[model samples]
Target: MKILLVGEYNRTHWNLKRGLQTLGHEVLVIGFRDGFKKVDIDIEIKDPLSSRFLKKVRVLIYKFFKIDLLAHSVKKQILSKKDELSGYDVIQLVNESPFLIDLKCQLEILKWLINWNDKTFLLSTGPDYVSVMHAYNKKFRYSILTPYFEGKITNKNFQHVLSYFSPEHKKIHAYLTKTIEGIISNDLDYHIPLIDHPNYLGMIPHAIELSQLHYKTPNLDNKIVIFHGINSKNYYKKGNDIFEQALDLISVRHKNKIEIITVTDLKYVDFIKSFDKAHILLDQVYAYDQGFNALEAMAKGKVVFTGAEQEWLEHYNLEEDSVAINALPDAQNIADKLEWLILNPNKIIEISKNARAFVETHHDHINCAQHYLKKWST
Candidate 1:
């Protein structure tokens, strides 16, 4: 099959491309590097006017001349690559809005993609209309919008949620859903909201290149190392404050027996390298399923404290929590769980082995690619 994956969100599409190629399918990816994380892509779409000075100039141009230079630039790049993007058997958009440009420009690109591809699919990897509606309807126990509903989040955070629920975005979602052949979710967090969609294909776990990651048996002799990487922008959304509070209490009580490391705003490569030796990785606290970061750490044989909600457990028909520690949003509970891991170091080793095994069984890139191929074929 000839597949073109549009956009990326934390190397998900890049890893999927690797898996598809291993299965003898030709895959091409086109998108920006996704901020400072610098995710890989086959064809690069540069956002050259995103710098501070250029942004100011862009704003002035729009204010006086009613011209959006950034959108113009992005549209130009996409049009220039028109010939190469055609005739794909399948083109999967990583999210509802795959381009960096505004909605008008995004729709322009989507129109071309719909015409060029035989079949198109949407991946529910991030916030989208249905997911936002699900949260607003209180479908999940809790979601990224919980803080907003409780009035505990900032205007900026609330506006982030509003983006998906807005009238314009809703129109975009409707158009995409009507045009696309199917929707595929990468995890339970995304899957729950799209369960009722008429064209929903099914959920596929995030594809991790298990072969690329080196699994190590966690050493239990020295102080147990615990690492938490934070993206400052999503600190509140990710419940980092709760994690920090828990870590603070744990550090005070087990300072001699444990080493707590916190890194803020590191690039993807540096983030992984920084916690290479850590025994436990603290992932997000308010999710119903693990994200790419947690899954990658699990592939490295590190016990991860992340979303292992009962729904996720039941989805896989698992009877145990051997792969990850289910992290709740309470500070005391989080600290207690960390303390328990500290007291019972042997369990860390056991979970580490189970973690790697879980990734191999469920998230192996090649196997996941096969799953995708089957879904696309249908």
Candidate 2:
């Protein structure tokens, strides 16, 4: 299949591209740098507001006018490459707003994609009308929006997720359901909302290239090292704030027992290396499954405190706190877990080995690609 993946998030599409190519499919990804992560892509859509000045200007305009000044220009960048984007056997959008531009402009791109491609589908790997609506309706016990409901994240900080409820975005959602071949989810977080929908193909485990990841049994000879990496943009949503509070408590209690490293918004490769010496990593709190970053860290045998909810555990047929620590939405609870790991250092080694083994068993890139292939063929 000549697959053209339209967007990326945390190297999602790039890793999929690798898997598909390994299976003898010609796959290309055209998307932005995913902010500071800077994942590789065949065609890059340069972000107009990457600079501080432009971002401040964009924010100011939206503050009063609720407008995106560079929306048209961003749209033009994609449309200009219509020839390169056209005639693919399959085209998959990684999110509802593939370009992360205005919804009105996204529709124009969708229309072009629908007309030019042989088969067009939506990959429910990120926020969309379905998942956002699911969370808003209190279907999930917790989600990325949980912080907002608890009054942790302000309205301005969460404007992007809130946009899915807009009239224009709703129109795009309706059109996608009517026209796309199907929607495939990335993990349990997205899978729950898409269950039983007519156009829903199914959930596929996220593809992780284990070859690029190295596992080391964390050396427990010295002070336990804890690494916390945060993206400033997703600080509240990813529950980094909660993690920080928990870490604060742990630092005070075990000041001599543990060594903590905290870094923000480093590039993807740099971020991976930034925590290379740590025994544990603090991933997000509001997800039901491991994201790319968490999975990568797990592949490196780092016990990650991320979403290891009941659904995830049941789906993977695992025990609670066996492979990874399920980071809930409470700082005190997280602090307790951190303290447990600090005192019981042997459990970290057990969980770290389990984490690496789990990824190797379920997230091998080629196996994930085969799952995608079967669904796409259907």
Candidate 3:
């Protein structure tokens, strides 16, 4: 089968392409480098004039002539590569707004792509209209929007959620859902909101190339190394403040027993390499299931502090506290958990072994690709 994957989220499409190829299917991916993270893609849609000076000029041009230079450039690129995009057996969009363009322009582009493919699917890799609405409606116990509703987060942090619920974005989501053949989620966070949709396909575990990750039993004889990578832009959204506050208290108590390493705005490759000696990785606290970062660390035999929510645990038939430690969005709870791990170093090795085993059983790239193949075929 020939497949085309649109958009890249934390190398999700890149790994999926590898998995599909391993299963003897031809796959192609097209997306942006997504800034400093530098996600892989076959064809990149460039915004050449996106620098600070150029952006100011673009705003002036748009205000005077109603010409959106950035959107125009992306649209031109898509049309230029129209031939390569045609005749695919299946085409999957990572999200509703896959490209960095005006919503109207994005909808127009997607309409053209829909006509070129036999089947089109949407991936719920990040928050979408339905998911945000669900969170706002209190459909789930807690979500990324919990803090926003509780007044614990700033208005800036809530803007993304507001955008999804906007009339313009709602139109875009409705159009995409109506046009796409099916919608699928890769994690519990997305799966929850999509559960009731008639065209919703079941969630699939993230595809991780197990062979590429090297597993090492961490040496916890001296100080146990704990690492946290911060994306400054979404610090509050990701509950980084909670983690930092917790770590601060824990550090004061166990000054000599633990080594805490916190990095800000590192590139993807450097970020992963920086944690080589870490026994535990502190990931997002607001997630219902582990995201790409936590999954990658788990693949490398590192115990991760991430979302191992009850729903996710029950889905895999996992017992409580078996594999990954569940990190809540409370400073005291997070601090207590970290302190427990520091005091009981032996549990770290056991959890590390369990983490690797869990990834092998559920997230192997080849197996996940096969699952997708079957779903797409249906």
Candidate 4:
């Protein structure tokens, strides 16, 4: 099959591409660099207004006129690839707003792509109308919107995420939900929102190429090393504040037994390498399943503090704190979990082995890719 993966979220598409290729499918990824993450791709979407001069010109044009030059520039870039992008056996968009551009422009570009492609599908791994609305309406106990509802996140800081609830964004969602062949979710966070929808194709776990990931039984000889990686842009959304508060509490209590490492704004390659010496990795606070990073960390045998809620636990038939810790929004709750690991170093080794085994069994790229192949074939 000739597959076209449009857009990427954390290395989701890149991993999927590798899996598909290993299965002898020709896969091409056309996506952006994923900002500071520097995610690799076959073709990168370059920003026409990336330069200081061009950005200034773009801002001035948008300030006076009701037009955004930057958005149009991206739309033009995608549209210009019509020849290269057409006639794939399948084209999967990473999200409703793949390029994070103007909503109307997104609808236009996607509609154009649909006309050219053979079968178009949407992946619900990122923010979309369904997930955002479900969380906004309090369907989940907590979500990325928890900070917003509690007034911890200002509108300016969360405008991008909040955009999914807008009328324009909803229109795009409505169109795609009706037009696309189906929507496939990567994990439980997204799967729960669309399980009953008619076009839902069901959840497929995130693909982690086991061959590429090296698993090591963390050397818990002395101090328990804890690594906290923060993306400055998603500080509040990802519950970094809660993770820090939890870290501070445990830092004082286990000052001698624990070594804390914090890093900010590292690129994708650098960020993954940043936690090599650590036994535990702090991922996200409010989640029901692991994102790409948490899954990747788990693949490397790091006991990750992430989403391992009942839903996830039940799905995988695993006990709590067996493979990964369930990171709740409460600082005290997180701190308690950290304290448990601090006092019980053996438990760290236990979860580390379990984490690697879990990823190998459930998130192996070939298995996940085969799942996608079956879905796309249908």
lDDT of 4 by residue, 76-124 (tens): 8887888998989899999999886677888898898888989999999
TM-score of each: 0.96, 0.96, 0.96, 0.97
Each prediction's total of clashing residue pairs, residues at least 3 apart in sequence or on different chains, is: 0, 0, 0, 0
Candidate 1 achieves a global lDDT of 0.88
Ordered from best to worst TM-score, the candidate numbers read 4, 2, 3, 1
Q: What is the C-alpha local distance difference test score of each model?
A: 0.88, 0.90, 0.87, 0.90
Clashing pairs for model 2 are none
**Which scores greater on lDDT, model 3 or model 4?**
4
Model 3 deviation from the true structure expressed as Cα RMSD, one decimal place: 1.6
Of 1 and 2, which scores higher on TM-score?
A: 2
- For model 3, the local distance difference test gives 0.87
Best by TM-score: 4
- Better candidate by TM-score, 1 or 4: 4
C-alpha lDDT of candidate 2 relative to the true structure = 0.90
Give a tens-digit lDDT track for model 1, residues 265-326.
87778877888889999999889999999999999988898999999888877654577988
Better of 3 and 4 by TM-score: 4
Q: What is the lDDT of residue 195 in candidate 3?
A: 90
Q: Which stretches of candidate 4 lie over 4 Å from their true place?
A: 51-60
Any residue pairs clashing in model 3, and if so which? Answer: none
